[model samples]
Target chain A: MSDLNNGRYGIHGGQYVPETLMNEIHHLEECYEFYKNDKEFNDELESLLKEYAGRPSLLYYAEKMTKDLGGAKIYIKREDLNHTGSHKINNVLGQVLMAKKMGKTRVIAETGAGQHGVATATAAALLGLECEIFMGREDTERQKLNVYRMELLGAKVHAVTSGTQTLKDAVNETMREWVSRVHDTHYVLGSVMGPHPFPMIVRDFQSVISKEAREQILEKEGRLPLAVVACVGGGSNAMGMFYNFINDKEVKLIGCEAGGKGVDTFETAATMATGKLGIFHGMKSYFCQDDDGQIAPVYSISAGLDYPGVGPEHAYLRDSGRAEYVPITDDEAVEAFEYIAKTEGIICAIESAHAVAHVMKTAKNYSKDDIIIICLSGRGDKDVSAIAKYRGVDINE
Target chain B: MSRIKNAFENKKAFIGFLTAGDPSIEKTEEFIYKLIEGGADLIEIGIPFSDPIAEGPVIQSANIRSLSGGTRISHLFELVENVRKNTEIPLVFLTYINTVFKYGTEEFFKKCNESGIDGIIIPDLPFEEKAEIKESAEKYDVDIISLIAPTSEDRIKLIAKESQGFVYVVSSMGVTGMRSEIKTDLESIVESVRKYTDNPIAIGFGINSPEQAEKYSKLADGVIVGSAIVKIIEEHKEDSGKYLKEYAEKMKSAMKN
Candidate 1:
């Protein structure tokens, strides 16, 4: 059984949702346990990951970046090469397949930057199940191209106008929907957050990133990297990138957070850096909240990382001192986003740029013999317009 | 027996819910006494949080209005203390877990005891996660009420078995909103809960009119009207107390019959 089933990472995770949704979560936990070790389930999931979503994504050496930083030899785990463009496809594929195995006819998900929603829609289309996605109204405007992509994939996109109309509100809207349709529908939660089974399930599916990267890095560099890094939002990619290297005590695991303008300003989503322990979205974790404990409205240029809360497991890791989290400003992320495109000819998602920004600043601290593998979580085609807007250019023109 | 248990002994109880400090604080204080005087057997006060995920647009808007009107947790507690001076009826807090956790769970419940509150209903804290808070609630003598919705199939028995104060049975499958019709086979649900424990059940969510209360009360020991009462506070503003008195009286009479 998964260690997370009891939903505690030393007092960080638990099912803190409404009683109306309790039975569904319990049933989900039971299903996850039964199928996790089941041979048939694993076999089918493995086949899908390999044939459909393109597993074993490359770990490419960033020679130009290494030279630019003038210190360590850097490597980028190209999760962007996955079929749906982001590491989110890894978890979506696993969840949609699980929904099929559980006899669910429909699947629902919430998205911020539209990456998770698109991945879910793609998986649902392949599995021949009905798909519905909830995106914040603000997100639909910011990431309009992704809205079109989801609709083209045959998923209905609901523009959630509630609350701040961002990822947090989208999560709230999806949870409400799931409660109403729990009988025949499954909520394909995008991140390693929310209630129990989800954090465990997403982490397990995404852990394959570090699993493959560890092997690839060993083959190429003859040893584990000095450090591994990824961006943290609801923290799927970071959790995935850090999971395998956790026990390798010498290997540092760092998570970069979107520090919109600055942590000193209210316009930030750096949960671990500036948040307090509070219960929201079914988990007791670090949440950006006001004095009264009400969830504070968070912000980031990268919509995907603009959530008020981090995954429960991330909270556990941070508290245990197993992993370190740092803030990456929007200016730093945008600079990295442009630099990688210019040097490596790769347009990376603004979300992934947060990690790249972290690497760009700290890579020079290590010697040339050191290896630093960063999780490049997604392609940036969906973010082209947003990037253009940030640069004061009209990409449409 | 607790006041909540005693409430169900005489006849079918009428439970009214309101988001404290909605419209204005003074009017909310007036509505509290009017709610009890209008025959509210038990009261559920809502501490408005920025994100109330379980609520529909009606209560959601009400929450927004209350929060924007500067309804702080401290203000709500003060109002609760004021209300305690007037009525000894069972009062429960219907709030999200974040608010209580923010206030410090043990501290929140301790204040509940000091201020004469009987129970609390956290819509986001399910049965499996209750142990942590339940310990604090027990130490403070505050009943952590259990809620069983229509979606709770086999788990109804489990929830009812461990429920304190009374069971809150959701009338429909959706969030808190008034519905013209409630099609769930609630009698069977009540029967399932009964197989576990003899806890008195109060049906809520989607109940608004006297007719709906009359219908649902037949299946349970009490009827909880939330969105309807909040809708009154939403529409009437400062004058909600007069309308709520008439509405609460009418609904309570229907539950009794």
Candidate 2:
């Protein structure tokens, strides 16, 4: 166990919040402490992952894609096969179980693409807790299917209209709701952000991805991967895949951000590459803001990636030089989307396509013998129509 | 006499409230001087946070404006350090607990002491959860002022006993703002507080007019008018110091007359 009190990679984490919610955050922090050491908590979480979530998703060797690229060996960590069709299930399950153990009866969350909301609702339904999700009006419109899926899972969806009416506004609305109902409801934050314990707790839960990937890769291949790549939107999936590899100095961790047009364009979601420290949605992180501190509008082909701020941990990593962040242009991501479909028969989400695009460029630079593991975070099922529209083709046709 | 103690002995001790880094750091420093010159016996500098829940529209807007002016915890320390060069007005900090926690507890108190601040008023920190801070602040010689709301009688006594310096009696059960009429029970509340501690009771949260100041000055040891002064500064944004001086003189004269 690491002593976070000394600070994590020079990033200080603590409970910085209003007085009213201190007791609740403190209680959650204490619970995290107990669960960190308690065998029962770990055992229960492991059981849920194995039995319910279908854990240890396959590390498929994409030999065809590798041959097509004529470069390094590429393997995909199929997190898309997990419950709810994404790596988000890993965190939602852990948080929902923690909520249940705390005797909380109501769960609230914020979502952009609604994947986390659907997963949270799934967990709440399984545990018989009332669930509510706040999503930005813009996100609800863009990711209408996910919104419908959350409602279908019996979770109420609130269309947040404030701020940019995107993920940031959804986060603000959720925090406001959490403060008023701190006693009875638990706010199951989607990302590894927010005050103190949440970033730590969410990271701890999501770390199972890297923990399993390390063993699976080592067992299948004779040695460790040369690089690990994942898309960074609040960086939950990326953090999950990079946590175990952070100290492995030889292995490089790459995070792909959405370059809506280009880095110079205001319509990008590259927090680490170009953002300033500011407070938004209950946490201090790199935020895309204008000179006056007003949040600027963010654009991305994937609704999930349309956030102005990245996770504080990601900012810390970027600053400490532990992880390297790069932007994948929308055109490049679409090209990768088509390439993966044509070569590997895998249609990746535009968010995941950002990672795919990065892997393609990065693979060409490495030797043919080198290995790179790309986290295929989510399935393209939710993205098929959007991809078709972007390519000026209908899926039915 | 104790600096805070002496001020309360002769007349009601005035506690001036102004947002830190308001307009700008230079303007905030100038505002503080104007406040002290205007007969403010004590000063409460507000450290603006991004989300101020207890603040009404006026104070909330002020916070947003100040944050837009780049007022962070580090900036606040710099402001206080600079102000320490000129005056020693028993400056008390009024901020939420997050800002304190953000700058670690020990470091926060150390910086406060280094800046020559006398006390702190954190409305969010309840008595039960403040033992650690209370102990640390005692070591650092920084008095932690406690607030007693209108609802809690028994808790008020406990707060009065534990609290150092004067007790900040919230005049109403609302956020910081301005109002025309003084609440009727303000005198009774001040009288109730006097039973627990001989320390001065400062009534605040809506003392705008000099008449309200005069009325509170007659009943309580001090009258705090924040939004009124902030409004004056905002109204005369182009020449903040001049307007602040005029407003402070008006407030001080009303307290005396």
Candidate 3:
């Protein structure tokens, strides 16, 4: 028997799932192992990304924000410009395509901000497969427009009312659904979390972010950026933004977790700040849990960052000091959201605003010669109503 | 001999499961006694977790109610001790791995020994990941019961050979709930398991009615029912003791040779 350390990143990841799902997980691992290197698989996926989904997103320089911050030059890696208006499309297309190849007729996924659900719905529609999405009832209410968008894409959406009616509950519902229909359906886990292969698979798919950003920045500035920043919910976008730059010891990889109201209070989703080591959601990682080891009900204004735990790789990165994670409170993220919208004439997703908030705070400390890249992981269109509500301005949907 | 092993001496065993502190801890104690009175050979006490991914809605709701009632691991150990004071019936814990891991693995096993717990079934702790807690469980003489799902195919024999107490054969592919009929080919799985080990096999998950219990017991050493009983508790609350006892008697008589 293999030890608990199998498929782990420094005692963080493992196959902590029920017996019924073990064989299915093993089969997925085998398929991923085979297809990750298959030339035909790569060719087909690349074409879908380039020709269909519109790859090679722009790395636009934020000249106005750079001048206003009066420090480091800023560039926004525009993953927000993807087909589904988010970085979620990168992994959704890959997994849905793999599902098609595996002879699976249906795909299921859990979403928080509905970005992932929309992306999965889009991919399943394109691939001629049935799609279903599980979203927390709270998220469905907050991101109602995206819910409609998914419905329009011909995907069934289930509002998971269990627990806190948020992202965590949606995951629980999705996992339960997959356990029942593992043979004919595939679970397109949205983030770089869950068990071993999921974290590895999603990270690899999203790594295209840093792969293109690296070449783009190097081509434009003739050097790697001083820092790479992205928001961390389950840390998919952050892992994507940080993966290629991990080898460059000089490039600072910073991940921003949602602080909700504040980290000191119970109402926060800052896993790196308030979480401890415990297993939940099929991975041993940092989880915000109560004394009895019950998973906590985490809160965040940005529904995308409202999860209780960060990915195992993020836990490893924090422990090894290879990367740094900071908490961005709702107030700061909102300020950054409005700041960027007014200054740069671009409204980034509230999830991406967490990273932008971090940059806004620390960019003034960097030298003018320094360059930093912030991954605008999604567009702000889905978050406008929620942000307006947060600002005490009601805009009826 | 281990209490769990002795539970299946000559006759087919009837195992009962319920979440501790559902409605209230006192009611759970009452429910267990009622099961014993109804001729349950062995009992499985669930330590309610915050997130039970493997469970269906019935057991999941029980977990939430148990947690909301302020049921803690310490309370469960005390409950086990209380149950032990009354009967010598074999008792085990059914819970997720995180509960034990968070309570400290070695310390948790030690408490199990002190509280007279015979075995533990962690659904998430598969055969491959058993090394972490196997030592602690062995040190405390607590059997780490192995579960074989319909999907466990080739791994059934591998797990069966190393099994200590009764092997829990899941009756269906999904999470635990009452089913009208089970369609999985469990006879072949049991035959494969019998080739490797002489341990008792108890099929669980969706075995609710007495007819279903009798039907499944014919193919295995025992039949375990959970959600059906939990549904009774959900319906009757604190007054579920007599209903549970009557139901258990019917299921036990149905399974008896």
Best by DockQ: 1
Give lDDT tens digits, candidate 2, residues A1-397. Answer: 2335522324433344444455577688888888778898789988989999999888999999898777889999989899888998999888898888888999999998778888999998887899999999988877888988988889999998655678877876787677656767999988888776788888888898889899998999878999999999888999899999988888998999888888799888877766776555445567776643445678888778888878778887777778899999889988998889888888777788999999888788888878899999888887777877888987664
Each candidate's lDDT (Cα)? 0.91, 0.79, 0.93
Clashes of each: 2, 1, 0
Q: Candidate 1 lDDT, tens digit per residue, B41-141? A: 99899889899989999999989999999999888878888888987788888888888888898998988888888999988888777876888999999
- Between candidates 1 and 3, the one scoring higher on lDDT is 3
**Which residue pairs in model 1 clash with each other?**
A17-B124, A18-B124
Lowest lDDT sum, 10 consecutive residues, model 2 chain B, at B49-58
| DockQ for all candidate structures vs. native | 0.83, 0.10, 0.80
Q: Write the per-residue lDDT of candidate 1 for residues A1-397, one digit (tens) a residue.
A: 1235377876788888877788788889899989889999999999999999899899999999999899999999999999989999999988998899999999999999999999999999999999999999999999998999999999999999988999999999999998888889999999999988789999999999999999999899789999999999999999999998988989999999999999999999999989999999989899999989989999999999999999999998888888999999999999999999999999999999999999999999999999999999999998888888889998785
Model 2: how far residue B122 lies from native, Å: 8.3
Between prediction 1 and prediction 2, which has the larger lDDT?
1
Model 2's CAPRI class is incorrect
